[model samples]
Target: MSVLRMQGIEKQFSGVPALKSVSFEVKAGEVHALLGANGAGKSTLMKILTGAYQADGGTISIDGRQVSIQSPQDAKALGIQCVYQEVDTALIPYLSVAENILLDRLVQSKGAGLIRWQQLYAESEELLRGFGFSIPVRMTVEECSLSEKQLILIARATVQKAKFVIFDEPTAPLSTKECERLFQIIDQLKKAGVGIIYISHRLPEIFEICDRITIMRDGQHVITTETARTNMDEVIGHMLGKSFAEEFPKAHVPIGETLLEVTGAKGGKVRHADLSVREGEIVGVVGLVGAGKTELARLLFGADEAEAGEIRLKGAQLRICSPKDAVDAGIVLVPEERRKEGIFVEESVKNNLSVATIAKWSPLGFIRSGLEAGQAKELVQRLGVKTADISQLVGFLSGGNQQKVAIGKWLDTDASVFMFDEPTKGVDIGAKSDIYRLIGKLVEQRKGVLYFSCEFQEVIGIADRILVMFEGQIVKELDREQATQELIMYYASGGE
Candidate 1:
């Protein structure tokens, strides 16, 4: 059997240790789960394995022979492939699905032959069929939904037929059916003798498919054990270096008068919707994939145009033509696609945290650098954003920390309504608690909050009331006391 091993892997960023002498391995035909809390070095190790980042010290071996992987091309040449969670960075939006799937092959044959469009599309379609999913081969990736884009990335990885594959948070954007399909695909890969490294925060999935699990904490390897021998609690304990309490930090904030009201809102996939949020109340918008929850959030935030609707804040009708208008009217949205729409990844954390309220520090056409830095530092500490310093690039932070920055940007604003769409999609349990705590603080301040997510249990634990959407409309509304996972799913799937 083939084996991929990294012994004593070490990596650092700007002199700060990220991974310290970490060791990991996977054998042919086994799914290995890599578990860690955010900033726990899981991503750093994977990046070294896939050659996205060069390890400062370590040795990698494939089937007992040491190999050097300094770049993505080097990794690919050595039969290694990865399906990263950030699909946009890996995919060319203007290219068709077929083209993106066959890009590597096209590059290898650049000067050898003419383009074979028909054969290419056929191969892509065949690969998609093997996954038991069908997406139009000719459709541009930009037109695809996040779920579809994830599928395309999986399909492309399959086309490579690599000896080892890495799937990073692959199910974060998928529906239940799609997630099951991915698990089946993993089974097939295992039967074909491919070593798979699976990284995810969903413990149930790790137990279901992974044969062995490796836990890391504070940039060091904690433990590696057979999945059957260990429990989820043990794994989480190792990841966090402490026992975990899986509870939403929902505070007891009394619901007050309605702060924001929407009537007959229509735009994007949101055909018709009416909703209301009261001060200090969290209104959860729950839906299955493509059920228009995100569309509704976008429309309310003015990210997309509202074809027809009445939006009122404090009983005053407001005309919101853009995001600026929404912000001006004391409304803000933390979008689902955080890397793309929320924070500026290339900027420093201080700038990202202060951008939403930049006007507060800028006067007479000049920015008060000292004041901005002080406020940024305070917010970082308040939100628990893990970074070396405020000057560090936001992109270097872990997924959970990046999310905190995204939400923190609006915290200093005078915004009365806070909307978060899939806020915990890629965050670990610990990070989720921190985010929930932040939301609770917002509620304590008597602000209206909207929580839009497909995670029913999360909504049940956090929201005061829940609204279920189906077929681009709000089909049902239930108080928190009346909400259940089954009932939410039933309405989300268009139940009568």
Candidate 2:
């Protein structure tokens, strides 16, 4: 028997349909996969299911009984919960882990009274222990790593005794070991008869963990079948409405003389790392989670001070004291955490696009509104950012569009070298293609790029040369023809 079902689900926002005649169902003890590209209404459908949004038209049934869910509280009462991809927003950073885990329970049990601090901590500790997690109950959520926070969200859902749980892109920030642990937890939940709705762009994961698959495209249901019955190509075709020819489009660009050279760069987790990128070259840096990729990128971007290093740009020694110094030296970094470091979420798309080049649009100590808007508009159209208007808030856009805005803002600068740290993280396949095309365009324009990624295939697909880092140092460098997934993994894991 199905534990949950929805039929003819229809939703529209601002006179445009976000979902259309969608139907879905989940059975007890089943891990059902939901697949879709960005802006294809997957999130909308999940929102409706979790009662974050009321469906404009649909019939929702729980245990064969039709019900109306008007709020998140109602969804909780009906035994539903969701773990969103944006973990930072989903969690209360300042709250203790114990409080966060039992927040709803504490509020309900207190209701105008002081929380039972001892009892709450004890219970939360036991709960986390049962899940094989050893996180300190009193530690602030802000102090935890992304993977730990993700596990806490799962524990919260489990504590709620949810019959149906929706996990949206939960593995995007996780390491391989953490992901394996998550898979184990999901197995436990499945064995406990809980229904799981898993959403991810990683096809291999879907096949490994999901029993059934439902593909959605352009806000409509396309296909639903058992995971064993469908292949990756078929699933990609369904989600995109056509067969995808190449996952990565690596363009051929001639490499020129050295553009930026780093010798014995030491800062943060990066120690004694020497690297160089030539003009028109895409240099991929591959490493494990703590292999110093991000730290190295930070040093290059001037986010962290290099204690001892010589940075040469265009054959001249350069000293970068701050991010502005890096930018002024023709080096710009598209950060890994787009929402936190790369964008001003509260600002309009226009403001975000023109932020880096505000001086270019302003002259004589005066701001020119017309020139700013025109420039932002052109870049918006050029980058294919989907927004109703340039004045729209950047936070409201999808992950892919938000990323485009982040990269677009830097394009206005005359930076000769660009460093992209996990540029395609949390984005869908279609958006990834767009980003790859953009990277190709950058290299074709004779600009150098430093591409850092945890995904080996991405490095192999986009990079002209690959550098594998291990334990805060570069262990090996390979040309594109010499780099393979096996070889990269060997060096990334500190193999001899």
Expressed as tens digits, the lDDT of each residue in 1-496 for candidate 1 is 9999999999989889999999999999999999899899999999898888999998999989999999999999998999998899999999999999988998899999899899999989988998998899999999999999999999889889899999999999999999999999999999999999999988889999999999998899999999999998788788887887756778888899999999999997899999999999999999999999999999988889989999999999999999999999999999999999988989999999989888889998799999999999999999999899999999888999999999999999999999999999889878998999999999999999999999999999999999999989999999999999999999999998
Candidate 2 per-residue lDDT, tens place, 249-342, comes to 9889889999999999998788878999999999999998778898899998899988999999999999999999999999999998899899
**What do the candidate models score in CA lDDT, each in turn?**
0.93, 0.91
Scored against the true structure, residue 422 in model 1 reaches a CA lDDT of: 99
Of the candidates shown, which would achieve the greatest lDDT relative to the real structure? 1
The total number of steric clashes, by the backbone 3 Å criterion, in model 1 comes to 0
- Clash totals for all models, in order? 0, 0
TM-score for all models, in order of appearance: 0.99, 0.95
As a whole number from 0 to 100, the lDDT of residue 421 in candidate 1 is 98
